[model samples]
Target: MRVFGMQHIGFTVPHLEEAVRFFEAAFGAVTCLETGRIEADDAFMQRRLGVPAGCRIENIKVLRIGNGTNLELFQYSGEEDGEEPLKRNSQSGGFHLAFEVDDCHSAADRLRQAGVDVLEGPTFVDAGAMQGLTWLYLRAPWGQFLELVSMNGALGYERAGGPKQWSPVTGE
Candidate 1:
């Protein structure tokens, strides 16, 4: 089998409502579908979802962000919930999501106005494969690391005839 494109990314959050609201208010994400609370007294939860037998999934929401990406947000309530602390990018299994904006500076300002914690630079890369790109990092309310990125025209690699980078704005 061969891969085509990404369909969605799943995130297990502490509070479903808060995550939904944050995505909607901060990034204009729209809720497209919801699978209400799911639970089982038997081993179905374990066999199917790989959760503990008595574990319960409080809710699942599917949201669409910007032009394309879809996010599947899940909220769980069980004995094992939140047993593991969130990880940083430097740690194993740690990851961050990046959103492409028209202007990185304006996006950072909007995030600051929303009282979001802006972490690192909206810094520009001077002479590299990523030349002309500006990016910054921020933290979501639930502590997920996110990035804001912007690029004008094409990148250095593209200008040098390397493979084109995938962009939501250009659909490439």
Candidate 2:
């Protein structure tokens, strides 16, 4: 058997509407699908997703960024307070999502003009395999760290001896 590319990545959010707006405004994400809810139980969730014993989420939503990856936003409550927004991508199980943009600098500038917090950005890499890459890291309204990256042209490794680079971007 073989595993192919990723379909989507899921993220838990405190507010569904807010997240929807963020996705729409930030990445021009389109709403693909939404669901009602699932019963709160250990067996049901555990068997499917191993989601502890309790915690049945409501208002599950899915957003797609152009033709790239999809973001699955699930609105869940009652797990605990303060955990609504995660901080520091340093913990053991922490992770960040990244999206490939056509022009990294322009994208970052647009984001800044939109009043979004662009933490670090427009960093150019010119030494390694990422030679022609430009990237920026920004925080979502809910504090999730996401990145905008691009290598509009061929990288150093690709020019030298690396395999062909694949892009999720649609339309040349």
| Top model number, lDDT | 1
- Candidate 1 displacement at residue 32 in angstroms: 0.5
Q: What TM-score would you give candidate 2 relative to the actual structure?
A: 0.88
User: Each model's C-alpha lDDT?
Assistant: 0.87, 0.82
lDDT of 1 by residue, 1-172 (tens): 9987888999899999999999898899999999998756647887788877666888999999987679999998875756687899999999998999999999898889899889867999877888989999998898999998998878888888998867899776
Q: Model 2 over residues 125-166: C-alpha lDDT tens digits?
A: 979978988989998887888898888678888888898755
Number of the predicted model whose TM-score against the real structure is largest:
1
Give the clashing residue pairs of candidate 1, or none.
Answer: none
Model 1: residue 106 alpha-carbon error in angstroms? 0.6
